[model samples]
Each structure stands twice: as structure tokens, then as C-alpha cells.
Target: MTSDSRTLQIPEHQQDGAAQKSCYQKLSDEHVEELELYRKNGLHPVHLGDVLNNRYEVLHKLGHGTSATVWLCFDTQTSAWKAIKIIGASHSSDDRPELKFQLQLSRSDLVALPTDHFWLVGPNGRHVCLVMPPLGPSVSSKHQTMDLEALREVSMQAADGLAYMHRKGICHGDFRTGNLLFRLDSARINDLSKGDMLALIGEVTKIVVETDFGEEPGSISPRYLVHSLNTDIFADFITCQIAVIGLSLAFEITKPPKTSSVDLPYASPQLLLRLPPSTHSDVWALGCTLLEMQTGSVFGTAPFEIMQSMELLLGPLPKPLQRTWSRVYPEEMLHPEGNTEYLTWRSDVISEIKKHTRNADCLLKELAMSRKQSLKGLLAADDKNKPGSIVWQVPEKQVTQIGDLIKQTLSYDLHTRHTADAVVQHVWFDQARIHRKPRV
Candidate 1:
């Protein structure tokens, strides 16, 4: 489908007028998918009690993406829990590349694949429903609480999964920590009753969808929108294995898609330069993911900001792309003299320290003031205003090794960049393998 068709547009009759204003209702809650998208070729409306394929019974909403809504369902035939991803009518097709790639890798242990797929004839059109084994929350959502050792394991496993895919001539166009999910123990979850499952994952939260007018949603929209559940309650049951998912953008190395979407922060320099997606680009993305795991934050959020940060840290763009970069971004927007955001963050930290030291002895207050001055001096350094230039709190030795690996993978020249297989064999991962501990 063309991009224009997927754009949300309210009917012309409901554009302006008392009747038009009465046609729509605003939802106050946050994190819910846009209601305007629940029309025509957008989302396929699935209710809480709806039984799909006469086997999978909908239990609760897991989450929703731009083109699909995922649900937790009970499999009557298999007597197990499964996740069903219902793709929107516009994106769903029997010959879609995502489905084809999924079926090709169904037997691989490195990725999560649909066990079965069927079509649902909705009011809009046919929606492709994929049944999969339920997994835990993404690694990015839970990485903050994990210790260094746990982070190492996740990094190693993720790199290995990427290497496995690259070897099969596949490129995961959108490779990032958010696409890596922790594996859940299916044996334990399968034995739980519906009531027990609810107790474990918490009750489902929903709010009714009401229009200003009295028009019924019927098949066009869901009766109520379900809030996505947090899977932190199952943290203890998360296994060491991590599954690489979100294959909608994945494609064969021989044939790159005409267009693709990727998270800005994790997007490789090649992708940002409008170069074709390749296995090398995947390696660059993996580098960004590894750095995020170690730092607990992304390097930068905006495209220009990320580009500036990359230049500051990884040196200038390759000679071949320097002219392209200059053309794409104006010189005025390239780099600013100082970062107000960074200064504000430092100021807040200093204020907190002073507030805590107010009740301390004179020597303690003096020490706090000395520390504040030291921070100020650090900020005065040449690279202080650069994004992601803060000093890492990890041990010096560990930081050096991790930084070396990341630099190798994030090389400006794709020819010089490390491949996924080479990344898995890096010295840092070798050390990680030697010191890896079992997750409790």
C-alpha cells in the first residue's frame, strides 16, 4: 500500500460542525494507540473476549505498534499461552516479506517466529494473525536494574543472534535493544490457569471508547482500548536466552526494501546517509545497542543531534560521504557552542548535592563545594558540550575494552566496520564469556 493511504484522515463530513464535533471523542489516558487509526485500513479491532481462529482465546492486550496489535491469548487445542499479532489490513498480505522471512527462520533458536498464521476477515479487510510463544518484556525496558554481569550476558546473546542471522544472508534492518526480548519459561506459564495468569501479570486495565455522538464502534473500532501490561512481575522467570524479534523491516541481503523505518538513535551512519541497508549497517546498529546497554541511555535522540555526537566521538564522516553530509545538514545546525540541556542537568545534580550536605559538618560542606567546582572544571573541557561525552562510571579497564569494541563496529567506513560475526568474536565478548555467571 502507498504511504498516503495509511495516513489518518477524518471523513470530510466530520470536519467542522456540531455534528462533526460530536463524531469524535478524545481519550485522556496516555500510552494508548491513536483512536483515529482505528478506521478503514488501519488497526483491526479485536475485543477482550473474542476468540480468533476458534482456538486462541483473547485474554489481555500485550501491546500495540503502528501496524499491529498484540494480545495475550489462551490456546485451547494446545492448552498453552500464546501471543497473537494481528497486522493491519493495509500491511497484511499472504505474500508479505515479513511472513516469508519468518517462515524461513521458524526453526532457528535465535529468533522468535510465528508457529501458525491465519487470516481474519474484518470490517476493513483481511488481517494477518500470527500465533507465537509469549515472551517477557524487552531488554531495554529492564536493563536499568541489571548488573554488569547480566548486561554482558545479554550483549553476548544478542550479538550471537545477529551473527546467526547475518550468516543466513539476512539483515535485521532495525536492530536495537528494544527489539531484543527476554525469554520466558513456557513450561511454568503453560501450567497456570487463567486466574493464576492474571494474578501473576496483574489485572488488565481498559477504558471505554465513547464518541461525542451516540454512534456505536461496532466492527470499525474496539469497544474499549486496553492498556499494555508490564511484564516485570515475571522477571524471576526470565531465562538467559534472548529472542531477536521485530522482523517487519528485515530483508534478504540480496534485495533491500525500497523504503524502511528505523529508530533514529540506533540507525547506522550508512542508513542516515540514504545508503542501502546491509549486514554492515546491522553491525553499526549493534554497536549502538551495546553502548546503550553499558551507559543506560541512548547517545542522542534527534537525527542531527545524533550525527553531531557521532562526528564528535567517532571522528569526521568518511571522505566519500562528507559532501553528502554537508548537503543534507546546514553548517549552522552542525554543532552548537554549548549544550543548555547538559548544563541544566549538571546544575540539578549540584543542587541536589548541596541540599543533602546542608545538615552535614563544615568539612562535608567544603567537600561538596570542592566537588561542585571539580564538575564545573570538567564541563569546561574541550569536549564537554559534545553529546554522550560524559565520563562513564564503569571501571577504567572494562570501559576501555567495551569502548574499543564499539569503536571497531561503529567505524565510519563500512568496509572498515566489523561484521556481526567479527563483533561476536571481539575481545570484550571473549572476556564476557569467561566471566559470565548464571542468571538467578
Candidate 2:
């Protein structure tokens, strides 16, 4: 069932010689020749740009991963730009026939998502493109110096998206910043000019370069200009997309949390252990994202570092981060320090920040007066009665948020954990304040 095979219904003319060279009998000689040409020239299948795919004119290559190459193509019928990800037979370790079967399975999963789902998906009969609205510039927490309220909104929107994925029982296995796309509009941050923001957007939109006969036809060019300050539903759409990408990419891992799964940095304990992703996992990652947004750097070294720290301070990494981390570093990670070590380390980091920023009181005050005033609710309590007050509970949510993030993303467990779903519903999500507007 190679892409070139009759079983797949791919036209013979479109089949490449390289595809034929595989064990699958479906590949044509032409497919094999293409593979040979690529092998001879050290050109990857990804390098072949502007090839025709039925009615679509492939304009340029988007990005390449270990298993597939995505292209930004132009649909001749609708005259629209689309992303087409072509998974080649040679890319898989399995036999071409087996690979085809797996692709069929994956393709089915690809289409299972809802039409409004911002994540990737393929339409019926069409090869998987994972069509998404064009991406715009990202709102870097570090770059923009967001108030607490703005940060909370970003987190909430991200939670909503991740929760949606978990509800569908789909895991975004390879979440990253590059995968996130947003709407482009005019936004004024403080005194920053709208034109300045648009210029930044221009830098991030996927680039396209045309070619002739697999040869360099010309230089690369920008696809379009995205305004950053436009206020409308479109703007919210873009913001939501970025929020999704932000959650997915947090604490990306190079290895699985355990031998059987991949562990995302900042994943909850459950996620690190190869457990099904849940809201907890999403929360853990969001905490890390917020930290990154605040610190302007990727935190943590390896699973052991975070796991050891979290274990000493509290216990196992949160279920969410654990699930994702388990997939990356499956070798049984544990916290090194006991309770004292954990407590000391936690206190040190917080105290250090407070010392430098004067308890972040000024910042919080400004945030309370800004558009993010709703977020203060996260720090305050709903009621002073009952067993415990909101202040005490707020710390729990914050701790769980941070701990789960560290555990899920940096732990060694590979099973029995939460995922994006759990993270979304964590105390952190339930606690964050949502204000109408904060005074600037």
C-alpha cells in the first residue's frame, strides 16, 4: 500500500521512481529513479519543490521531520495556499507495504479531528496537509513583558485548546513552538508601533522558494504580511493558536521519559510514565511555559534534575508531565534530595526572585491595574471561611502547577500519568482569575 501503489489510488504518473525501489510492488520505475537522483545528488525528497500533486502546485517546502516532509502548496482550483505533508516510503524503517499500512492508520487518525480543530488534519481523499490558518508572529512573554493578567489569558486559551485535544483522545506527540500558528493583526504593546509588530510577524511566517526541475529557480521570498494589532475575532483566533503551540512545545525532550515513551520537559508525573495524557499534563507544561515567558529561557537540564528536585521537595513529578517525560527518558528517573533538599531549593528560587524584584509587588500592582486584573483572583481566595483560605489554596495550585510541570516534563517514569487533559484541569486552571480589562 505504498503511496505509489494502485491500492492507495495515487496516480501512476505522480509516483516517483524512488517509491518503486522499495519492497512494495506498487511503486513505479519513475519513483525509483527519483530516489536515485536524490541519492546521487545528496538531495532529500524534501528538496524537490514545486512538484505537481494533482491540481495543487507545490510552491515550496515547509519543514522536514524524521518521518515526513511538508510543503506549502497552492491549490489551482481554489487558488489557496495549503500545506501538504508527504510521507515517503523510504522514510520508514518498516517495509514499504507495512509502512503504507501504518500510514493508512495514521491518516485515519489525522482526519478524526474536528473541522474547527486547530491542530493538523487531512481532508478526505486528500493527502494529509494538517491544514491550519496561516501563522502570525508570536507574543513572546519575555519580549512583550506581559502583565500577570495577560499571561493568565494566554494560559486559559492554551488550556482550552489542549483540553479539546485530550477530549478527542488524541495526543500531540511532537508539540513545539514551530508547530504553533496564529492570526495576524495590529496590536499595540505599550508604545510599540503596529508596523514594528508586523515586521516581526514577517520573520516567523513559513518561507517559500520556487524551483525549476528540482534546481534552484530563484531566491526565497516572504509569503505575506500579517498585521499584529488588528482587534477582532480573527485576532483571538491567532492568539488561541499561539497558546496551543506554547503548551505543546514547553519542555520538549530529545528522549522518551521511559523506554516506551517520550518525556516532554515540564510534563506531569503521569505523562512521564507513558500514561495517557490528561489535563494535568497540559497544566504542567503551561506552568513551564509561564516560567519561560517570565525567565526568557528554557529551564531544566534532564529528567533526573527535575525529578530529583521535585521528589525531594514534594513527591513524584505531577502525573501530567510524568506521562510525557516517561516517553523521552524511560530509564527510571528519581529525585535526589529528600524533603529538606526539595524545600530548600524551592525556597531559594522563590526567595531569589523576590529579592531581586522586591517580591514582584510592583509588577503585580501594575498587572492588577492593567487588562489582566482578573488574574489577581488566582493569587487571592474565593472565601476566607471553610477549612482553608484561598491564599493557602493558591500556593497549592501554583506549586502543583510548577511541580507537575517539572515532574511530567523532567521525570523518569514512563507510565501511569496524566497528560494535556489533566494539566488543563489542574488547580492552576481552576484558580486563575479572568478579568474583563486591566488598566494600563
Clashes of each: 0, 109
Where does model 2 exceed 4 Å of error? 1-49, 88-131, 137-147, 173-179, 184-264, 270-282, 308-440
Report residue 283 deviation for candidate 1 (angstroms).
0.8
Which of the numbered candidates is closest to the native, going by highest lDDT? 1
TM-score of each model, paired residue for residue: 0.79, 0.44
As a TM-score, model 2 comes out at: 0.44
lDDT of 2 by residue, 1-440 (tens): 00121121222322333332232223242212122222211223332234444544544344444344445455566554445544433332222222222233232221112111111212111222333223343444122234444445555555455555555443444333233344332232212233432343233322122222333221111111111222222333233224243222222132222322233555555554456543345445544554454333333555566555345333343444545554555443334443343332244644543454312333323322332322344335464431221111123334445444434433234343445555555555554533423211
Q: Model 1: what TM-score? A: 0.79
Model 1 alpha-carbon drift over 4 Å, by segment: 1-30, 330-393, 434-440
Worst 10 residues of 1 by lDDT: 1-10
Shift of residue 418 alpha carbon in model 1, Å? 0.3
